[model samples]
Target: MSPLLAADEPSNLPDLEILRAEVGSAWSAYQDTKYTRATRLIPGILADAQRAVRSYEGDAQLQAKALLAMAYQGAAMVLTKIGEADLAWMAADRGLGAAQESGDRVVTGSLFRSVAHCLLSNGRLTAARDLVTDSAGYLEDGLPDASPTYVSVYGTLFLVGAVAAARLDDRATVRAFLAEADAAAQRLGQDANHMWTAFGPTNAAIHRISAAMELGDVQVAADQGPRVDSSTLPLERRVRHTLEVARAYSAQNRTDEALALVLDAEELAPEQVRYHFISRHLVTAWVRQQKGKPSHQLAGVAQRLRIVG
Candidate 1:
């Protein structure tokens, strides 16, 4: 057995509730861009979860396995953002397996969401879209009367699929998926972090901005930019939305605004923004667009983010 997953290793398995709480805390840290802390917390949680699933039975095992899946999802997300797609894929695959074992469809779909994201990060756009499309369809049944939680889960799936489609430049599929997700968001009537999916009208709108940017509709994205309420989202997502807006502004030759938005994202989540692909691209563009020497702050940001020498 791999040392990391060895059932006999010195283990400090928390109770199932504590395990769940820890995973939740890890997710919160992840959202706040405290990636160092979150990443450090994942391996031990994963170990305990694996042991629990192997050693326990009944609901306890199911719950433990579910928590393990969440841990894998979080780890995969961070790994992917850091450009470690192979490692991320392993975590995502493990997560999907654990989710299926738990018999929670929403949880399973959420894992699929992470898997699709990892695939996209690895440049497997077609695979990512196909996976998310199939997963979303798997959740389509009984939607009319589904609980708010289920709807949000499916909405999150649809949004992920939309992103994949957008990356592929498949405008038709992108719009279709976004519309479905937006409808789910409208039904919710407000923002919610249900099951940590963070699906709601505001989140759907944020996705729209991203989609617009992906489609190279700088004007449309800029027009919709002001409508997003950053306060309604978790810090990580808020930073992402801000960066997407920065991209739109960059595309429109609004260099000053784009630079400001990139700086804003850095201020909101320094670690996340510094490591993000969008931030890298924007910083490069911002530097190239400057007519003269850049500001000290901008130079420092670019140097620290390694986008400039």
Candidate 2:
């Protein structure tokens, strides 16, 4: 149960071969701004993956729970990144439920870390902090210190810490946690081929850019994000990365570039990909609003934003 697979619902009930193909194609399409095609297939994939866990007949509680928890975590990521707060939280809750059922402390730690992430994405920073602290206790409970999974859990905890600090406008704390996350992630470099790290590098960097922007360092984020290659990222990735870039531009008073990037992203992605819609739209609107103030205002705009899980 790779946690990465939990992000999107594939649209069909294909076998492993077919499902993998579907996810691969979807990832490619998503990166290329083919949301109309991508969204059409994601939900089913997610549903099928979630359903598969129900049939896990394994005797090992740790393995089963870890697998199931990853499923929920994946689902939560897809929903939250796409701005579907309700569904994202539900998915997180479901992951927590699975972890509780298996009683695997390590998986339980993962669950708390993930659910806290979902909450942080939904603007529940205090709740996220408490949960991350709770996860720390689970991490301390005989968990192997050197497992990639353990390192990943600590990375998640630092991410939550970064978000909490971001919410409070605590620049020092934000940098500290974010740096810790990067370092934990780097520690896993020994297993760069580890499946856990395939997307970890890109994903963690994205969050780092987010936290950097939150800490009022768009210049640093802009300089840093070039490494993410937005054009080469999938639909969800590009949409998000584009927004971050736009924010960086806006922060630097590069209004023309910011507005242009906003429009470009809007034109590239579809409304059905609400993950791209609401998340990027707010940033676009804010940037446009900022540009228009004190002399001129952004004009000819109508926004359609849907709040979902």
Task: Identify the candidate with maximal lDDT.
Answer: 1
lDDT string for model 1 (1-309, tens) is 122765443364457888888888878888888888887888877776787788777988888888889889988888877777899999999999999999888788889899989888888989988997888788888576888888888888878878889989999999899999989899888899887788898889899888888888889999888678868778888888888888888888887888888888888788898789999987887777678999897798889898763
Per-residue error (Å), model 1, residue 50: 1.2
Q: Distance from true position, residue 26, model 1, in Å?
A: 0.9
What TM-score does prediction 2 earn? 0.66
The model with the greatest TM-score is: 1
**Candidate 2 stretches greater than 4 Å from native:** 1-66, 103-107, 140-145, 190-205, 222-239, 263-274, 277-309
State the RMSD for candidate 2: 7.0
lDDT string for model 2 (7-53, tens) is 33345322544544554554454445554565566666555445544
Clashing pairs in 1: none
TM-score of 1: 0.94
